[model samples]
Structures are given as C-alpha cells and as structure tokens.
Target: MAEVKQDQVPQTVGFLEVILTGPRMSGFAGPAWPRTCTIYVAIADEVVAWQTLPFESDSDDFKKWRLGIRVPVASNWPDLSLDIFVERADFLFRRRTNMVVVTREGPHTSGHTAVISRARLRLLDALVLGDMDDEEEEKTMKRRRSEVMEGNPRLLEGTVPFGKAVKLQDWELPAPGDEHGSPRAVVRGRVDVRMNLRPAAFFG
Candidate 1:
C-alpha cells in the first residue's frame, strides 16, 4: 500500500457521535424483563431505535448489540436537543432524570428540580455549530469564529463509563463505581463507550 499523507486523511466538522461500546445488562431470562428493549434517544428528531436483548447472559459482556450514531448538521434541522433514555418495563417504574436540551445559546442537561453544571454543558455543546460555514469541507480546517471546540470536535475520546458519572470531555468519566460499586445499585452492570470524531485511520 502507498503511504498516505495527512491531507489525504478524512475528518468532519459539526458532528455528534454516540457509541454504545460495551453494554452489560443485568436481568433474568424470565418474563419479568421488558417485552421489548428500545433506546428512546433524540437525535435530530425523536429516535425510533429499538433493540432486542437476551434477558439472561452467561458472560459479563453484553456488547453483542453495539451502536454508533452520527448526527449531522443541516440547515433545515429544527431540533436542538439530544434526548437519551430506556423505556420502562412492565415491572419497572419511572425515575426522574435530567434531559439534555440544546439551543442557539448553548446546551444543558436539565430536569425539573435540578440542572447540570455549566462546565458539563460546554462538553455536550462540543459540536453544536449554530453557524457552520456551509462552504467549508470536512477535510479542511475550520476558520469560523463560532467553530465548536477550537480543534477537536469535543467528543468523548476513549472508553468512558455511562453509569452515574457523566463526563464526556474527559474520557475517564470518574468511574467511581468502576464495577457497579454503587451501594444502592439494583442493576448490576457496566457500560464503557468510545465516542470520538473518529480518525481517518479507522476507515482505512
């Protein structure tokens, strides 16, 4: 193979990607589990993604169903938030949590009673380019003053925990409960994801 120059590598501007790297769900194979498994995550619009998983697992890893979503910026797109959640099973009840809301000003993971820190909001706003230059190409460097993340696309670089701790900018994500360490934890499993802009080497 011929050596490829840096300029030949591919890249993207105004991109939002989420990866379900390794999902370890805990449940019995009985009917108690949800009749269906659906990921109600809001991308450009309401997400209609559903998944069927084995209620019981013999191994510690349930990554058989991995996901990679890339949300692109379009002039006509209206929605500004990316909502993520799991549907409730018959035996399960609802729990209050913050909803990620985005707008021309900024993004925030907000709930009725509480709101996420401003620092965290900046992390999610990594790719929300309100006025991205339509003339610019993906491979070319961005020069717009409103460009998100000076250089990087502001994606969670490495395998980060998707549990209680939420830090997308920092790949580590402070896995205090690295192994389901939460004392009151009912669901016993781990989720490590790698959501990046993705280097061109990966496509190669």
Candidate 2:
C-alpha cells in the first residue's frame, strides 16, 4: 500500500495484491501448488477519485477485497467500485512463453457487477484511511462541445445527446476457496459510470 497526500498526489496509483480468484500467473500465487492469480490496479482521471482493495487469500472476510471509488455527486451519479480476477498471467521470460489460468467453476464465472453501497464505502474508508472532506476533494469540469466534437467524430456526425444522463447498474463475481484453505477462485463486481457529467450543465 502507498500513502497519498493531497497536494503532491501522483497522477496515477497502483496496487499489487494476491488474486484470490481468477487465473494463475507468475510472481503472484498461493503456497498451495499454484492455484491462484495476481492483479494490479491502476487508476487515472483526476476529476474522479478511485480506490481499490487487493483480495486476501487466507481470510473469510468477504469485504476484504472490496473497493470504493468516489465520483462527483453533482453529476447525479453514484459512487462505484470494480472487482477483477486475474485469470491469466502473460509472461515473457527469456524468450519463452508461459501462461497460467485461474478460474472459478460454477453458475457465475467469477465476475459480477456491483453498486458502491454506503456500507462498501464505509468499509473502504476504514481500510485505506481515505480523506473525504469537502474542502479536500477536487471537482472536474465538463468537456467543451468543441473538444468532444473534435475527439469523437461520431458525435458531430450524428445527433447524439452529449449530456444525457445514463443509468448505471451493479455487478458481482464469484469467490471460491480451495481444500488447503486458500482462495483459488474469484468473482468480479462493477458499476456503470458516465464520466464528466455535471448537474449544473444538465439543469441550468
């Protein structure tokens, strides 16, 4: 875990933790004959703040690997999180190719969507010691029509609702344990997000 301060925060943050589920890969696996996976979390976009939790292989605590990411409420959007399983490890070792697969066998394929519930946020704040003071948080502005139009040719070519509010849903994945008491399978959860939408822009 890395410490982040308000003023000198890096543009991007990374988290390395054991993949309790998903696929097997090099450099991250449990002690039991290589039955798990490893994952990395990388986040950008300063306007929206995000956080992720690495899954723990030995604990029965379901909340250990959950994440909480904050988006501007002015956008009329909910806070969100994502659960990812590292199903495969792509390795380039001395010109040889090796890959490891980690998966959960059941009705759910180790992946599901999620909405960042209030409970989830509280749990995340405690885990990461996140500071959410109004004064400290940063807000981002909406992109100019020119910029949006320039970048997305489709928008200019068609009658797209550039500022429409899109409803987001929640998802979840599967987490399975092995005989040796290690988490060998994982599930995922996610929320839909419409970036850069502001309340004032939509209303007045």
Candidate 3:
C-alpha cells in the first residue's frame, strides 16, 4: 500500500470491497426469526453505509452478499478502525425498565426517573489497517488500543447484569443476548466476510 501524500488531495480514493458470505445459524433454528438481515458499517464513530440482505429465499445465491464502499485517504488511516455489525430485521431498542424513585429530604422531595433502552447485535467485526512504514509499531499500537477499548470502566449495575465481555475491536457475537445475558428470539447464523482493498482509480 502506498502512503497517501498529506499535502495533495487525490481526485479519487480507494474502495473497500466487503464480501459477506455463508451465514448460518447453529443453535437457533426456526422461522420466527426474520429472514432479512441488516449490515451497518461504521468508521471513525460515523456510520458509513447500511445494507440489507434477504436470506430467507430458497435460492442458494442469496446466501452471499457483497458491498463496495469508498473511503477517503486521510492522515488518521492508522486510527481508522472499520466496524461492521450484522443484525436481524427485528433488532431494535427495547425498553426494559422505566420507573421513578422518590426520596424525601428535610423539606423537599425529589424523584429520579430511570429508563433502560437496549438492543442486540448478532455479529460484529472490527478491521484495522496497519501502518505500511512500521509493522512492529503498528502491532504494539493495536494491542494497546484493544486493551483500552475492551476495558469496561463505565459499566453500570442494574436489572440488566453484564454478560461475558468481548474485545470491541476484533470479536464476534454469535448469539447476541440482552443485557441480562438472555438470548433474544433471533436465529443464529454463521457469517463469513471477506474484505478486499483496492484503489478507486483501478478497475479490474
């Protein structure tokens, strides 16, 4: 990979080709689960693209899906970790709890209202590009970043207990569950994804 010049803005950029294939469920098997799946891609905390796949069809070709996304070259390439999430169609925020607790003081009473909103992610993958100049430094930096991102310092305690933690950067949730560690009514399917990087100016 060639290093992009900082002073020059290229007329064209590179395209990140993502091929998601062979998604199958192991423990979950049923028709109640939505046959359609949604894919969300996020880079630098911003959602880049969203795609949906209709996997319920009996056709074999529908099992695989491909996406071509354009990405601009910038100095933050090393910090640009691409995150992908695959979820069922029914995946959305569910209100678990909503209540108000009243506390009385000497002369005044205050009520604290709390609301819980949650969602489940079927599969998640994070891809980080390494520095072409220094491989060792890139590895070290990745490890440190992984450690810091995985640490749950702001986790709260409530009706939803924390489940087994996984690495945020490079990890997959096969059967995503609620905050209480209980799996949702979604089917489980194995997803295979292949990513190919190419310059936008190239056509092959």
- The lDDT per prediction is 0.36, 0.27, 0.40
Q: After superposition, how far is residue 204 of candidate 2 from its true place, in Å?
A: 27
Off by over 4 Å in 2: 1-37, 42-79, 95-204
| Poorest stretch of ten by lDDT in candidate 1 | 112-121
RMSD of 2: 18.3
Off by over 4 Å in 1: 1-13, 25-35, 59-61, 74-79, 89-190, 197-204
Please give the lDDT score for candidate 3.
0.40
Candidate that beats the other on lDDT, 2 or 3, i.e. the better one: 3
Tens digits of per-residue lDDT for model 1, 115-192: 111112122333333222244432232432224334443432321112122221211232565775433323323333
Q: Candidate 2 lDDT, tens digit per residue, 166-198?
A: 121223333454434542222233222222222
Candidate 2, residue 7: CA error in Å? 25
Q: Name the lDDT of candidate 1.
A: 0.36
lDDT score of residue 18 within candidate 3: 46
Model 3 lDDT tens row, 1-204: 998796666343444454544443333442121444465666666778876644454555454454556565443343455565554433223356553333332112123321111122221222332222257645654664454467523211110111111221212234455445643333234344444334444553
> After superposition on all CA atoms, what RMSD does each candidate show versus the true structure?
17.6, 18.3, 17.3
The number of the candidate with the highest TM-score is 3
